[model samples]
Target chain A: MTELYQKQRAMRAMRKAAMQRGVIAVLDVGTTKISCLILRFDGVNLNDEGEGVGSISGHSGFSVIGSATTASRGVGFGEVLSMRESERAIRTALQSAQKLANIRVDHVIACFSGGKPRSYGLAGETTVQNQVVAEQDIARVLSACDVPDYGDGREVLHAQPVNFALDDRSGLADPRGQLGERISTDVHMLTVDEKVIRDLAHCVKRCDLELAGVASSSYASAVSSLVEDEQELGAACIDIGGGSTGVSVFLKKHMIYCDSVRLGGEHITRDVSMGLQVPIASAERIKTINGGLLATGMDDRDMIEVLGETGDWEHDRRLVSRTELIGIMRPRVEEILEEVRSHLDAAGFEHLPSQQIVLTGGSSLIPGLDGLASRILGQQVRLGRPLRIHRLPQAYSGPTCSSIVGLSLFAAHPQDEWWDFEMQSDGYPTRSLKRAVRWFKENW
Target chain B: MSQINPDRYTRSDPAPSLWSYRLLRLMLSPYLRRMVFYGIPALFLVGVGVINITNEQRREQVLTTYSEMKTFVTERPEFTVNLMSLKGASDSVMQDIREVVPIDFPISKFDLDLDQMRQIILGLGPVKDVDVRVRSSGVLQVDVVERLPAFLWRRDDGLEVLDATGIYVRTVTSRLQYSNLPLIAGEGADTQVAQAKQIFVAAKPLKERLRGLVFIGERRWDVVLDKGQRLMLPEEDPVLALERVIAMDQAEDLLTRSVKAVDFRLQNRPTLQLRSGAMEAFREIKLMQLGQIK
Candidate 1:
């Protein structure tokens, strides 16, 4: 069927709306923080090949007009822990962000951290009704795929036909009029717990905002941060948040797979808290200020002051070496990376051309995190910062803000997805959402 | 000194039936007549085909082979030389590549030699055509054509060159030649090369003056600076970029001279860059490009 069409149109409409309205908002709902950003869309910057839009005012079309973040409550492991508190957090972040942008938003595409995300490279084939594989025929073959019922209480987050094979030609992006007896499709589908998605959707609803769409935080982070080459060949994005670490894999510029580890910066904080006998907040401060994976001979002599709960302990806390902190924290950080590596392996990440890795999130700021990650993840690793857009606030431009900035860019221009689709059902079918989107406009 | 004799026209009279007459003429032209009149090679070809391939089954066999040849490209896999990696030229990057590719190659199975594959796939992400050869001294040699970069991706790590295929063939240590290359930024860049390639390949008209491209959301692309001026284009199609480029040149004097940058990530309008103030100075000099900003 023509499923790819609706997705394409929805994405086109969202992008068009952002361009026309000139302002867009991105909302990131994580287990630790609810961040919001308002961006002003600029011009249609055209490249020589006439792909991708250009900048606004001769600058990148996106700029952070306003930003606001609230401490996330009633959240654990990246999913809503309690509906009421999550709603309050959502309202608080949005209200402040709207005040800064000086506008109101009726719809919000929320990015969450929960869900046991799984990926499948499904394929389908059909002998073309005639020798030529028309779009309809492609759709038919895609629909013909015996896509298993992903089970109950689950939603298909992303269903995309990544590659197409027409007759003897493999890897064909579009095979509409190609003469072929058999056409095959490689579709990547990602699904998550229905209850988690439903809760997030309900939370948005409770906030009186329409759920335009939903994306995995790691997936969105990967979109805003990864470079073209990294994405094409293959790359993994590790988003270490307060309560969870999100992992997303990209190949062919699409998030072929996504998953989240129920551990993140929170674990580090806990390790510091239990080790040093400090409050959660104080542990966070120390972790950020004196964090390192490698502590050498020089560290033992480096003393740090640990403030305590006894209101009058001023200097009573003994100084601890940086090496001591690393000794405590390394195991946790290493655990997270190992978990991510397993996730990537399960996604078949090794098959891609390039195996570069990007590390993002607020907690990735530890001094030697990139080095540690590269050593552990078995790839070229670098800490990721959000791509520069117009009017981005200097305060929010670091790796700490990759998710919110990414979410904003995502809202203004949502990706091609399944809901934005139209099933041709002309006894014809397509698996890719973009084609399904396009199929709707022209056929549906 | 060479002359044609009138005796060459000796076969003008008829044979018997149309088939027998034609057969006799064919037979006589080379063997019976042309042997005494014209040549032998042409006669041999016609006799072989007429005698051997005239049957329906034989004719079908020949047609089938031709059709098969059209599809499979059955020439020996042509030892395609990729030339993407080099042995010692920038060993760090070369070493980095080893992390992603298998250290011990399956050369035997692919009918490729390690030395040959090393030369073929090395330094070749952007290269279009490449050839591998053995030197007289037994050194493996390679000839390559690298992919032309349409944009300069300025990332958190460093600047790298990406071709239409979005392969980061080499890092751009020098921006002197391509100071205004389009840029592709963001995370997961290696995975999005296909998207970048689509955009790069689509930016054909602006190729001569293209500086670099920037990738924002891994889903779409943004045109960074072009001709030193800024132009904004949409993610859908750079038709707006094309129109703005045309409009600026036709009306606003866009790219008429030097440009600052262009924004085309929007829907309708394009922001023309004019170096009028500190803000632009702030915008133009990225921290990564600070070293080269003389």
Candidate 2:
């Protein structure tokens, strides 16, 4: 019995050590670009020396050994538009990163950005069989979650037992071996588009990479953007991208719900393109330079030069007041915010303990955007940048890098799944948790 | 002019139809015969329908029962247990449970408890743990985690095993197979079980270094080293106090040479109490040791 117990502990220690040294590859399949980073870890030893002394901590190796990114093709609104083009793009990125790291990368975890995401809070209860809820009972309650029929083409991306309740008692973190009359559990199920999930998986497979896991882009963004306190309490992460805006709600360090709006920075660019009568590329530049939500003191006397595509040098001139630019930018941004508000409302955002809103992405960099968003959101709104990384290239450290940086962290410290619990049936005498009922009786 | 009874008008009553044939003859005509003939068959059909429906329900129940039995036969544990004795436990309680239960095997395989089972068995001097669990179908499962026979502590209430946790495992026979353990007997031994548990947990790293532990007061503990000696420990912050003992082991060849006991019941420094009960040796453990506690 002692030998059996000792062997079990030894195996667990070995598994934890093995995970620290393995190579992990991340695939970020966005509409604009497909980035891949192949990281070779030196194992997770708590006594590593660096500037990352106390800031970013734990077993996900804080060592950055390799990274890579490439422009995306044949992808639209977060799904692969053409399999061949997307496959080629992924191969290019992976090969480029592998070249830099001087290593062969095989396994990959990809983050998806599209799908009409909805949140459902389901709860289930069962009686304690042995006068207590043991580990088996916990597994039973989670399995009894009816295996929600998330349509024919969809697959369950995440099914987590968020909170547990014992009889009339609430706020139980770990209900294992605890006694009560009835044990109830709150399960949060997240589903993704089957076609999208499968196609991305196929793309990775085509690139000769095993699909280790899949996470939502919005969820990955929240990981790097939201701080530890925000994650512990609750916060909404809004990432406005090139072709769409993704919204994710997090509490207790896990994403409870995620959604996306099809309108993004491109819409704002299009609005400027029409208002200033310039090329689409020129409108983007002008928007970056002159876009603002507030235009109170701006003078009509201030003029802006516009470059048209007429090809005649004399005709390539136009002027517009700052007020006109504000008029064009304000409505589109407000429309995007309005759509995001409905998304938050529908996901039951009010149930969260904290109502802080952290906005990220390239579109969030507009001047006076926070005040406008705060007015529209009716909550504390602040621009967010991904935290917890060292010696980050200056060009890659911004709101836009939230998902990529978060992907790095997520790959490093993936949570232990159900199989991590040891349920060995050997020579040791296994005792039932019947006496746990004494706790309830004593408290009553 | 009383209205005829429904039963008297109907053929369901033989008395109304058999003797009063003349009156029934008129009622037995085509119009009346149609009602009588069809009504009887319809009643019979209803009866037959109910019988068939009930038979089908019974068959379904049998099928479900067979399915469950198949699963149990395949999944239930195949345990090897020998029945030692049945004494204090009530046979009627076992009988009432066995009426609906399908344990399918003989009861002689498992040990049965009887008599004042709780007091007697719990009073065992050697046994350490008792765990009991009940299944949903009313089957009781009992597991006993026993301790090695050590010492008999005489207390006012009774004798009990001073386990690693310092709690009473049980108390009964003092003489048993387990040896190489020191014994301590005194008044107020019941209060030392929890302290003993702390000592066992704290001295995990010093496995071979430990010989035996004795209760000094209930709040204090006396630890005997491998060479047959003792160290008295104080109640307050005993962990730090044990660290001091570890330091002495390094400064002096404390664990290497033979000595009786070291008393640290006082906070300042450890005092030695020499009495070579099991091993023979030395003056003061000449300090020079420089090995880790592991």
Candidate 3:
């Protein structure tokens, strides 16, 4: 737990240093594509710097001055499988984007989608030292949370204080300067397998750059895809990417739960290639052009060519009805949606005030996905697009770039983590039993 | 009207119709759908290709014929800023602006940066703010908001006119130009025009004997008189207590007597320093009163 706290503090310090230097790059390392967005800070507006996005300040105002994407190589299921191949791909994307922006950036905030994310909601409370809950008390209460030994091979990725309560009053966003006898806090902690992070850090170091910050791709996706009201009330953003589907639940503009599934669009592509007896490239093209779930009588007559390998002439070309193509794609798409539904159920997503599901990502562009998702997930679903920013290229403004753009937003104005609050070392006890007992009493 | 219920009509379950299903499938079929998606872009590419092949020869043919007309249109005087004009400015400040910002006429308005010209015009001393714009009629319009003179400040260097915000409006070669405004004299008096103005308004009753107000150390005021009397005012609420002094003078004719100076820095004990003759008379009267009492 102390190591986890120290790592969070180190990341915060790096983020502050990177922000003060002005320009930072955001890299979204996905299984299918690696995207880089160079963000010029332009110095924050002094009057309203700390206020969250959707205003004229924060990361939403940053322009994607330089953006370049390359086909990902040596990445499988959103983790780096080969260091050399991934490093080369990262360098190509960063160099081309930096060349376009005409400024070299050394600090980068990277996001990844793998390592099996798990979420926990922990609460702790502390007495108000001076009758009024000051910032120090808030920090002490947050530090006082008993971080259950979340296994040996895992590390904390995001720990956010989602809600605060002062004595009998609950749902307090900020309790400082208020008179209260006790201050209670609920912090949402997301941990991932540590080996995946070490691999990513090594790959980044090989590219001759410093990793200023790290964020979960699922959390970043929700930040970009969900509308302000949807996030404030409560909604789930399911980012269906190439090799994985990321599920994140945001409430009060904070990510309270996040999980990732191993199945994604590439599996469906594999299914199409194997079912239609065609190459993977041809399968990808045909799926993107002609894939859907709902088919009817007229689709039985509509035929599409299954382009084959060039070696054999007679077997090189074949024709299949659109209904057959839908027959192969529908089951797989439904399987993915069902898996997402189960993950949502496991996260207690139904208890949220609003259960609107927003589907975003490259694979989410499949026609009739929202209708199918509604049937399975049983929520008011809508196709999510990244909130429009100034000067963003029309090409990169689609659902595929949601995670990267959200990473850019996260880089500019990170949410207030536990480390942001100032803690007094002299007065704070080092893991006392009385505080743990108090936490259990207040939370349970 | 047959005992209708809205729930029956609004039910989510719609009876599956075969004809609508066939229609939806017809629209959703890949062959027709791909054409619906890629047809426009295919047609656009073909159109662009044909145009590109024909445009080279078309440009060669037409460019030779239209060269003279192109030159004639580009050289038109209406498209250029030929006759420049300045509005809403006095003659002298306008002349100063024109001299500082030298412009070559018969130039294209696209080449002119209006913001730079606005900054140049605003740099003039009396010009508080200015707006430089180009009219569609081809005349350059310069709208000026000149700072008005608020007070006449007499200093060791020279007399100058100060604006309401204590900014120097213009230098006065002679005091007669702004004699109607209240005159202030001292070092740093131009920075305290608002305070000096308040004191002058309070001393309006002593207008005839009032010479001018002198600012002391840029903190307080000294009301000078034509008969060489001075009133030292307190730093805080000087104007209100000056009004009180004016009321006292109106009641007792204090200014007409042998008072050299009045000090009101102390709110409770306002001391009037009398002249030598009055001081000696006061001491003799005090001594005679003491002997009588013994």
Candidate 4:
């Protein structure tokens, strides 16, 4: 745990250095595509009046100077499968983005949606020694949290203090300088397979980029797609990607739980290829053109020509009714949504005040997905596109590029994680020095 | 009867090779790009020039070419000084000036050292001041101001004409050469030529008898009249003393007497030395009156 804390602290320091350089690249290494967006931080906060996470929803502090996307290779379920091929793919996307921005970017904040994340809600309590809650008391209470044994071979991705409670009062956002006998904190810790992080880091390093920070694609998409009120009132962002459908639940503007199912649009594309006897590329084209969740009587007459490159003319020219294509695609999408519903139910998402579900990512672009997701998830389901950022191109404004856009926002305004705070001093020498300083400060 | 096409399954590579991507990134770096685009080319040109001019012979050749180009611009018809035009000088003085300057015509104006030439020409005796410049149409204009001769000083070596400020204009063999000029002779007489001229002016009535005014003792003047007679005047107001002598000559015919010299070195006292014959005659007449030798 200390080793991971030190490593995360090093990455946070690198992120600060990248922010000082004013140019950082956000990379979304998805299963279907690798998108890179270079953000140039102008250091001008538009709405910096009130302190706790000022409105980065407007994305005013940074601007997207360059954006490029390439088809992903050697990446499955948002995890790098082959270092060489994924390195090449990352190089392609970053090189094009650097060429467009006419500047070289060294630091990258990357996101992936694989690794099977598990969320643990950790609660810790400590008696206030000084009767007034201080930063050290907060740190002490946070350190008092009993970390669960999230099993071996898994690394904590995000450990954030979601809420603070003072004595009998719970849900206190900040308990500093308040009268309380006891202070406690509720921390949300998400862990993932350590091998996935190492592979992604190695891939980015192979592309000659420093991995400044890494985030889960589900959390990143939730940051961009979910509205502020929904995030405050408990909403779930379902990022239906190519190889995975990422589901993240946000409450009080913080993500409490996030998980991803290993089923996405690529599975539906494979299903279409097998059911209709067509190539994967043609099936992908056909799925995008004629894919719908709710089939109508008119969809039966809407025939889509599925093209093939076979030498036989008859085999190249094949037509499939839209109803038949929908028939091939809807079940897999429903399965992905149903998997997301089970994960939300396990997370106790039904107990939240607002069960608003936002469906986003590349696979969410299919027509009638929201209507079907509403039936399965809740009635408050809506198709979500990424929030508009400055200088984002028209082609990347669709629901397909939500994770990349959200990664840009995450790079601009990262949430405070556990490593961001000062650790509680367990050594006696520093504790005595701190006590002396506190005594001197109080007396003089 | 469908045959699968193998090419449909394969995808072309879109990534650049590692070295090429690194090279592109290095080229995109602003510092390296500026160095390759501007710095290296400029440094190369300067280095080539330095190497080409490193040899002594090549350096001399370059200097000669630069001078030749400079001369080509300056030696145009509008810039060439072909002739010299002299003003305010007599023919002899102008000839002397021409010989002293010694400038070859049809030369570039840039090659003309006018200040040195002017200093050389000023060394001539008659030239008091000179102005030399190149005017339009390539004419070198020399304006000479010659000194005017005022007095003739009879030095021991020869007679030389002096300007009014006692500067020697030229020398002559005979006094008749500048007869219209007054003659002053003494060791330091030339420094007081103005006082000598004033004394000569007061003796204008005795011009027929006045030979010249000699500066005696360099402080007083001695007006020399005909028949070897002289009038000694005071140093402070020698002209006024000479005027008193002229008044005495007009009122009492004192100059016509047999006196050899009149001394007015003292202001209130006038003394005269008579000739020897007049002295002997006056003494015998005094003896007859006393009847000592009758």
Winning candidate number (lDDT): 4
- RMSD for all candidates, in order, please: 52.6, 40.5, 27.1, 11.4
lDDT leaderboard ranking: 4, 3, 1, 2
lDDT of 1 by residue, B83-180 (tens): 33443334444454445344332122233354655554564564455555544333335445545666566678787777655667667676665765
Calculate the i-RMS of every candidate, to one decimal place.
51.0, 49.6, 27.5, 2.3
Per-residue lDDT over A242-261 for candidate 3, one digit per residue giving the tens place of the 0 to 100 score: 98999999999889999999
Error of 4 at A277 (Å): 1.0
Chain A alone, TM-score per model = 0.85, 0.82, 0.92, 0.93
lDDT of 1 by residue, A120-212 (tens): 668888888888766467667777677776887776777767777977788775566678888888787777887888888787776555665
Q: Estimate every model's Cα lDDT from 0 to 1.
A: 0.68, 0.66, 0.83, 0.89
Backbone clash total for model 4 is: 0
* Candidate 1 ranges beyond 4 A from true positions: A1-22, A42-62, A311-316, A419-421, A426-444, B1-294
How close to the true structure is residue A411 of candidate 1, measured as C-alpha lDDT?
60
- Among the numbered candidates, top TM-score falls to 4
**How do the predictions measure up, each by TM-score?**
0.53, 0.52, 0.57, 0.67
On residues A3-31, what C-alpha lDDT tens digit does candidate 2 reach at each position? Answer: 42344335334434434546667778877
How does model 2 score by TM-score? 0.52
Of 1 and 3, which scores higher on TM-score? 3
Is model 3 an incorrect, acceptable, medium or high docking prediction?
incorrect
Worst 10 residues of 4 chain B by lDDT: B1-10
